[model samples]
Target: MALRLAQILPPVVLLVLAIVGILLVVLPARETTKTPENMYGIVLDAGSSHTAMYIYKWPSDKQNGTGIVTQHSECKVKGRGISSYAGIRGEAAKSLEACMQEALSQIPKSRQAQTILCLGATAGMRLLDIVNSTESRRVMKEVETKLRSYPFKFKEAVILSGQAEGAYGWVTVNYLLENFVRYGFVGKWLNSGRETIGALDLGGASTQITFETAEKVEDESNLKELKLYGQTYKLYTQSFLCYGQDQFLRKLLAHLIKTQGVKSPIFHPCYPRQFNTTIKLGQDVFNSPCTKSYRPAKFDPYMNVTVVGTGDGGECLASVKKMFSFDNCTYSKCSFDGVFQPTVKGGFMAFSAFYINYNYLTRLTNISIRSSNQMANAMRLVCNMSMTEMVEKTNQMERYLKNVCAVSHFVKILLTEGYVFDEDAFPTISFQKKAGGASVGWALGYMLTMSNLVPAESLGLMKAMPSGTWTAILTLFILLLFFALGYMLLIYRARTKQDLV
Candidate 1:
């Protein structure tokens, strides 16, 4: 009876130890695995025409040292850009109130304090700074104060340089297109092997061209070197101030007034026929620094000047051509106005006013512009359309409709003539307003850069035990289970042998 009891007790104890060892290894592993919370960020794009706030989010456990950011929500500020509130002491800051409140609602209170908030003023503020440095500083200070009132981790409110703007825009384009990095089938972020494309941004007061190039950059200022996802890129970028659609139109009007001697009933070749309007000499035509060169020597600052349109598409193209200087090429190549540029390479994404103008052209002509000739045809069709016909067909406001022809010609000339996107390369330029559910702009790129400042939580710290310790313990438990089974098998074989005896 004593021998039987000893044999049964030995097997029972071994089985109990095996079960205990298994629980020790499995229970903590389950406890250690957990899904991380989502993180949020905000970027306010204070462009020339308006201010727009974009909210983005990513998993706290970032991918490959960078956050996988995606647009969560956006709010357009109610008023014009902050620069328009230059003289009004606090108005610029007040302009951001509605959008700031919207951001508050979009992100939870728990995360608001940690969420980064930044405001980057583009060409509008840059222009204001160029014109009035004191006023620009005051406006930026007011905006900074207003942002600090919120719970967010306010970073900065400053005017972005044209170079920074162009570079950030390029980053936004490539990031959204997944040219920088992409999720692989193995569930890891990997560098995308695809070639990067160029970025063409046509704002109200500035136009920028940026693209990766292997050619030597003669002008050091036009060259920008950027590193992303462990890959480095050498880019050539140029920002033309006072050459945007709005500013170019101002320059054109100022030019006509200068050449035509500021007479009432002045003829404008770009405007549709029978479209006449009265504008103040100082405010409308020569108010901008862009037209400072064309400002008349002696004229009433508020003199009313009447202008009439002839709707001559040929004349419009010819006049637009006069605005750019194709002569000077100090470098190996030049785009226009003496700016150095390497040959435009790869595909291009045109956005902002470019996309808007392209949309209008397509809607008006019902044709896709694949080449310069096709673009010229579309421009002529829209140029000849009378105000009534344009308003009826486009269902657009009169103010916006009148400038369509002039702006369209400006864009056409700016692309083919100014930037020199030839027939073969023209088709590669895609007019896009949004990509990856986010508006195609520099703001996302700015946020992606800021995300690098955020530190990622360590996986080992999140787990119940260190990975090495866990592995060692798991191995020990697995081996113990095998040893217990082996012992039980040996006892069973001995019992069978004894029964045979």
Candidate 2:
């Protein structure tokens, strides 16, 4: 009887110990599995024409590549871009107040301290650097001061270089498009197909073109090797300073001024036939880096010129063609003005002023210049119209009504003559402001980089030890060991009972 009782008690104790060990393994895992709270960030895009603020959000625990960060909201500044406040330096900082308030309203108070804010000024500020260096620094400092006064964590406010602009723009489009190779444990690694589409940014003061290429790059300088999301890519890119719509218009205006002096009435094919406006063309117009060195030196005084519209699309196309010098070629391929560019590869997203002008070409104008041969056709349609005809046709204000032909023709020539993208490659380009419900611009990517969301090291290599699955497996092994020990005790107890019998 003593032996039987001992055997029974030993087996029961073993079984009880196994059950307690199993509970310890499973219960703690359940309790410890915590979902990381969400974090927030803000980015400001200070363009030549306007300033825009973007709010971004992501989980606090996921600071890996791309890190699940997405643009949560956007607010446009009350006035024009920060560069526009170059004259009145105080106003530059004030312009951002409206947008900063919106950001505070959008994000919660608890997360405000952790939230990071950054500002990036594009071509507009770059142009300011050339035109007025002292004013540029003063404006930047003022803007920075205003940003620091806010509640959120202010990172930096700086003018983005053309190279960083192009590279980051490419990252923005590809990130929004999900055109990246993703790796992690939650799901199988997803490859975003063959390659990423190129990015074409048409800002008011400058334009940027960038694309990933496997072919031999014509010029090494234009190629940017970037390590983002733990992957390396060689990109062919170039920023055409002063080739943007507004900048080019100035150059064209200067050329017109140099050719036809301000004292005389200038007939512009870019304007409507009945349209007439008095513009003071000062030395600022001709003295620009775009037109100054090329054309003759002129007086800095304001020269009044009456712009009378002459409806001739053919004449307008011919006039715009002169702005681009497609002559010198140092590389195997060049875009324009002797800038090296590889063949435009993959698809491209043409944004900014490109979309605003060309998206409504056929639908609004009741014109069908869908193809490149119709470049001059769209130009002609806008050029040949009278001011009253345009006002009646578009039902818009006079300020909006003007520069129809110039904007339309600028897109045409920039695509065909300047970038060398032929008519057949037209389908490869998409004119869009947003993709997948997020704004398609460099601001998002710029913030991601500055906040360290885009990591430099591989996630797999960065791990000190395996996580998620490995931890689970370790817990599972301890559970199995307890069960094994219980089984051994049960076998020994049974054998002891048998021997006693």
Candidate 3:
């Protein structure tokens, strides 16, 4: 009986080892085949013109050091930005309700609590904070309260500094362009080793320029350092406040009113020859800090002034040029307004108002802007179009159509003169509204950093051995176990037969 038990035990042990070895190989393979759960994040961009909400998602198991975050959905909050709701309590937070509700349907209820939600107010709030800190704090608190009421894990509601905004935008641009890290053909995540592109963001109240630069940044404040996908980059970033499309227009209008004198039928060189509009001195033009210096000493706040279009392209360019001060440069190099900037190197992605104006100009004139001359020619055609011709050609609203020429020229000057992108460098600027299916902006970058979605180091594999090596070893072990079991059974059977005989 003891001999019988020993024979059976050896075969049983071999069978068990074979089963264990099979599972050791098969289970990990199964895990690798299964899809990872997805994580979600929400970012609300509250700009001066309007507020927009973006939803982003990524796999739970990140590849390399970065989450493959992509825009899941987006909602544009109706009405103006949160700052516009200032002086009216609770309205700022109320404006975000529609977008937040939309987010509820987009993100799964199960993952809502785990999902991160953040709100970043840009130059509009920054300006508001400068003008009225009390109102700014109140708006932020109200917005925070509204966000907390939702199911998501509320991160924070804060006004992003100009430097932070610029840096984050740079990240967004490069991340979308796959300049940091990319999946190689070898089924592994690899550093792209591609030259990073620059980001040129034109919003309602500010414009930001950020790029990787090896040259020494003259202004320490303009220099930013970032680590992404295990790669370090030294960046030069500068945000010019009150230089956005809307604010620049305001400044331009104020400059016109100040230069031509506040009177009926003020001639505007940028507007179309047939276009005319009525604007108030204090409310329409001088209400913001950007145009505060140009406010008339004795004009009524509600006084109406008529603005007539002269359709002069040359004068329009000259007038836009005056808005920038290129003389006082304390640094080795300056962009415009005496701000320090390294040479605009590499390709650039210009978004927001830049793309908008470019799109309108291209559609109106059927001209592609590749050089300074091309842009100038496009502006001349757009500026010369009549109000009726513009409406017919573009099929856009009169309000938007009227300002196309001015905005286009403003963009042209901002790029060629302000940012110092000369003739040769001009073609490198690609006007784009979106990249990689996501809108080009700082919101994604902000969410990425705040949520720790991007780690400094790549994620290590779960198993120390390669999957192929594990498979080969496990197969060998199983085959050996099978042979051993077969041999032991045969031996046991032979011994039983001999004993029986």
lDDT of each: 0.83, 0.76, 0.85
- Cα lDDT tens digits, model 1, 1-501, are 788778777767867876787675677445336766768999999988899999998767753455556788989998888988888888888889998999998899989988999999999889999999999999999999999999999988879989899999999998888776554422344556899999999998899999999999999999998866556789999899988778888898888888889789889998889999999988787777889999888889788988899998888878888889989789788889888988888999999899999998988888788888898888879999898898888898888888888888888888887778889889999999998777998998888777662223211111122357667866776777787778778888998999999
Q: Sort the predicted structures by lDDT, highest score first.
A: 3, 1, 2
Cα-lDDT of candidate 1: 0.83
- Deviation in Å, model 1, residue 264 alpha carbon: 1.5
Provide C-alpha RMSD values for all models, in order. Answer: 10.3, 10.4, 10.1
Stretches of model 2 off by over 4 angstroms after superposition: 1-37, 63-66, 182-189, 283-287, 294-300, 366-370, 374-376, 456-501
- Write model 3 residue lDDT over 215-248, tens digit each, in one string: 9998899888887656779999889999988899
The count of backbone overlaps in candidate 3 is: 0
Model 2: pairs clashing at backbone N, Cα or C within 3 Å: 313-380
> How far out, in Å, is residue 19 in model 2?
28
Find the candidate with the highest TM-score and give its number: 3
| Clash counts for the predictions, in order | 0, 1, 0
* Model 1 regions more than 4 Å off: 1-36, 453-501
Q: By TM-score, highest first, what's the ranking?
A: 3, 1, 2
Residue pairs in collision within model 3: none
**What's the CA error at residue 8 for candidate 2, in Å?**
45
TM-scores of all predicted structures: 0.83, 0.80, 0.85
